[model samples]
Structures are given as structure tokens and as C-alpha cells.
Target: MTMFTRNDKGQDTASPATAQPVRSDAQPAASPVAETRRPQAQPISSSSAAHGTPSVSVISKALKITGQLESTEDIQIEGEIEGDVRAVSVMVGANAKVKGTVRGDQVQLAGQVEGKIEAKKVILTRTARMSGDVVHQDITIESGAFIDGHCRPEYGKAEVKAPGLKTVVAGS
Candidate 1:
């Protein structure tokens, strides 16, 4: 990314187009002086990371998912879902009711789910109810949630079956 910078005197610096590092054959590969000036990432200890991942947000009530929902950004369902949902992060709302499968990087439920769920992270919130299986890398369930069926941290694609037997996807 190129940045437009201003000097302390409020004068515009030279355009980034003219700012190019000159190539030189004398340059050495990997210098400790340059390395020390940069911040390094320390390896995380085994214990802390083993605990679990974190959540971005929660679902309330109002929104409704009637079909397959797919995205890469984080999402929270606040109303009802009648079909599948796919994303990087997902949350079933407190008053939400999902009747189909959900596929995401992370998924949480606080209302009701009747189909399978596939995600990296899965959470069943308090007052949430489910009647299907959950396949994910991580899962969390608060008190008041009701669940039925299987719960697998990892599973195959063959195991994920959406209910209601739809033949085609929307907007195909």
C-alpha cells in the first residue's frame, strides 16, 4: 500500500511513485540490524492455545435466514433460519430458529437449530435448542440451550446432510 505523507510543516512529501529503493549488488542478504528493528512474534505456549478460540459477536432476534447463507465475514442471526448458512463466523440468534444445515468457519447457536452444522468454532448459547449434529474444531455451550443428535469436533463431508431435501441452491 502506498501512503500519502505530509511533513511537519504541512507540506506534501514527494509522490510515492518516485520513492523506490535502489537495487545494489553490494546488499547483503539478512542483516541482524534490520531484524532487531522489527517486532517479532513470540511462539504461543501450548497450554493457552489449547483452551479455545474467541467469538466476535452474538445474535439477538429479528433477522431471518430462510435459505443458504454464505459469506466470509462474521455474522450473527437474530431472527430465524429456514435453510443453510455458510460463512467464516456464524451465530444462531436467541430467538432465532434454524431448520437447515449451517456451514461456517465458526458457528454459535443461541436459539434453535434442527439441522447439521459445520464450522471451525461452534457455540450453543443459553436458551438455544438444537436437534441435529454439530461438526467443528471448537464448541461452547452455555446453560439453557437444548440440543439433540451428534456433536463432532471433526467430521467428513458425507456426514453433513441438510434437512428438507432441497435439490438446487438459490441464485444458481
Candidate 2:
């Protein structure tokens, strides 16, 4: 048998570009290895497996919140809040305003807070206007700051649970 197959009109019409060698065993052609292979998965490193990095959340001047805000990272507020805020560090900008409690490890205020502040370290800048109580372990108030409430060094004196820690009840 010849390598080229004949057409119905009995003419040899095999061209070099359109010709493929035929095998005697009659097996189908194999596909490329890349087409049938699966992609390899990347290994996870220890650094990538852990919590990647600490983040800083910002509340801009145009926004306002009326509910509670809590975070494990830092927070910078330049807006208005009508509820409590809890974070690792909190910075209230000069033109910002808050009408509720602010709780953190460190709290630096340069705006107006009409409620309470509970923190380990608290700083009231020159432009800070506070009209509520401040409970802190350490505090610094500038000369030009205005405060109208009690300043008590009562932070950590009570049993306070951290932001994300689970509290277990002993008795039913």
C-alpha cells in the first residue's frame, strides 16, 4: 500500500503542507505534554501563614459613624463618631469630634470628645476639647487643652477583657 490515500476521482492529491504520516498500528496521535499537565501548587511559608501585617484604619473627614468601632490594629479618626471605639491605638484629628467612649492602649486626641476615654496612655493636645471623664494609667494634657471632667488613673485597675480575647465563665 502507498503512503498517500487516493480520492474518489482516482487522483493523488497529497500536498506537503496537508500531509501527515500514517501508522500501520492505527493508534490515535498523542497530544502535547503541556496541554495535559496540571499546574503545580506553591508552598506556603511561615511568614505568609501568619497574620501578614498590622493595618491602620482611617476615618476621613467626610464620614460619620453612629455605632461601635473595634479593631486589633491602629485607627486614625478625622471625622465624627457617636459611639464607642476600641483599638490598639487611636488618634483623633484636630477637627474631628466624638460623642462616646474611646478605648485603646494609646489615645491621642486633638479634637472634641464629649464622652469618656479609657486607655493605658492618653494625650490631649493643645486643640483638644474634652467634656467627659478620662480613665488612664498615664496621661498628658497640653496647656491650651480644655477638659471638663474627672481625670482618673484607673486604667488596668479593673478586670478588663481585651478586644478579641475569649472570656470563659466558670459556673453554670
Candidate 3:
């Protein structure tokens, strides 16, 4: 039982050696005063000004989302999504599952998608399994990918517009 007990002293001692480098880095910092002030401000409040927000949002493998997801920045999904996803760039990870439409400037899928994909550029990787139509200005379907619906190169075409919108007169 004594042998099984953790020996944390070794790790604690090693931590000081690593900490010395950080101390040395702090000593030569261009703005030491600003760096000290930033830490003080960070402890007072957790704000985006202290640490900038990420430009890309990641949906981890453990997550399951059921509503529409819209973002101007890129999105990486490794979980399950049951509703529409719209982003500047969307990446569906190898094990991700999406059950609704995905719209983006660029879309890369390596997982299972059960609905339509509309994008300027679309890529289906070897392990991708798509069960619906894909509308893209440019598309690449890898050799081992599985697709059950049509792949149409008509992403930005007028025909892809809403059905009633095309029939409506501009002034009326």
C-alpha cells in the first residue's frame, strides 16, 4: 500500500525548474508592468478583453445539439447535431452526425450527414456517409465515400432559390 501511494514530491520539485523559465521570461518581457496588470485584471474578472474569443467554435465529441447553429466564424463538429448548421466554414469530424441542412462557404465532411449540404466548396472524405443531396459550386467525393443522393454543382444558381421567390415579381 505504501508503494502504491503517489510520490508527488518529485513532480513538485520538477515544477520549480519549469517555473524558472517562466520567471526568466517575465523578467525580460517588453511590458512587465502591463503583464502584471493583466494578471491582476484577469483575477478581478473573466473577460474577453483579458483573453480574446476564439474565431473557430468546436463542438466536442461528447456534445449533442438539437437546434439551429449559426456562426460567422468557422465551426468544427465532432458531436451529434439534429438541426441546421450554418457557418463560414464547417468541418464534420470523422465520427460526427448531423441530421439537417449544412450551409457554409466551405464544407468538409468525414462523418455521417443525413440531410442536404449547400456550399461554395464541398468535400466528402473517404469515410463520409451522406444520405442527401449536395449542392455545391465545387465538390470532391473521395473514392470510399458513400452518397445516397444527387451531387449537383448548382450552389449559387438561380434555380436553387426558394420556390415562391422565383415566381414573385420584384415590384409586386
Candidate 4:
């Protein structure tokens, strides 16, 4: 005998019917809880975020780099570097130290560099202590800066060729 039986009206009672199968091409309806918890995509705005200025790579005083550093943007060094550095602009902080070549379009030194510096524009502040040659198109040395090598204004020019060789007579 069935557990459920007919009522006075002669209609049998049963469980609810199963849900219909969803179509392959149709999108499923989202539940209210799921819809409320979903995150919405927002358009990014410059004023709310970082502007057009490219981010600069900074080497803080507590760190040191033993390998080369190359960047298309600016670099500010306040630590120690043992290998070469090439960037668009390099700024050596007052307490920084660099023992390798520094090459860039603009270089501003206020610390110590024991290697060469090659740039289109070089600025040596009062606290600068440089011990190697500087190859630059334009340079500014403050009154208290110390330099131990020659400052050559040859950046993009070929090495100077020796004057015309003097002809030597076999017998004079």
C-alpha cells in the first residue's frame, strides 16, 4: 500500500515534479545570493591611480646589488652597486656607493663612484667623490666635489686619429 493516499476529492498526492533540463545554448539563471555576492568590473581612472610618470626603481640604503642593472626608465640608488648600471637617468644619493660603470642619458652623483661615468649630462654635487674618468657631453662639478680622473667631453665621437704620419728620408 502507498504511504500517500487520495483525499475526499479522489486525487492522489505525490512529491513535486523534477525541474526541466536546461538547453545547451541557453544561459542559466543566476541565484539572488550569487548575484548579490558577485564583484563588478570597474573602469580604471588615472586620477585615482598612478599617472603617466613611469615608475622608478629604487635601491634603498639597506640593500646591495652585485650584478648589472639595466632599465628603460629612471633609477635612484641609495645603496651599494658593484656592477655596471645603464638607465635613462641615474641618481646616486648622498650616502650611496657605486664601484662600477654608470651609463645613462643623465647622471647626477652626490655620493661616491669608483668607476667610470658616461652620460650626455653629468652633475657632480658638493658631496660627490668620483675616482674614475667621466665621458660626457655636458658636465657640472660643484665646488666641494672630489674627482681623481680626467673628464673627457667625447661621447659620440670617434677616437682622435694621429696627425698625418711624418715622412722619413732614407738619407739626410
lDDT of 3 at 78: 99
lDDT of 4 at 115: 97
For each candidate in turn, the TM-score is 0.53, 0.63, 0.66, 0.63
Model 1 misplaced stretches (Cα beyond 4 Å): 1-63, 155-172
Model 2: per-residue Cα lDDT over 73-95, one tens digit each: 78899999999988889999999
Error of 1 at 14 (Å): 45
Query: In order, what lDDT does every prediction score?
Result: 0.61, 0.75, 0.78, 0.74
The candidate that wins on lDDT is 3
| Candidate 2 segments exceeding 4 Å error | 1-54, 159-172
Report per-prediction Cα RMSD to one decimal.
12.2, 15.0, 14.0, 19.1
Ranked candidates, highest lDDT first = 3, 2, 4, 1
List clash counts for every candidate, in order. Answer: 2, 0, 0, 0
Q: What's the lDDT of the predicted structure labeled candidate 3?
A: 0.78
lDDT of 3 by residue, 1-172 (tens): 3332233323322444333324434353333333433534644565565676566789999999999887767899999999998887899999999999998889999999999999989999999999999999899989999999999999878977421223323221
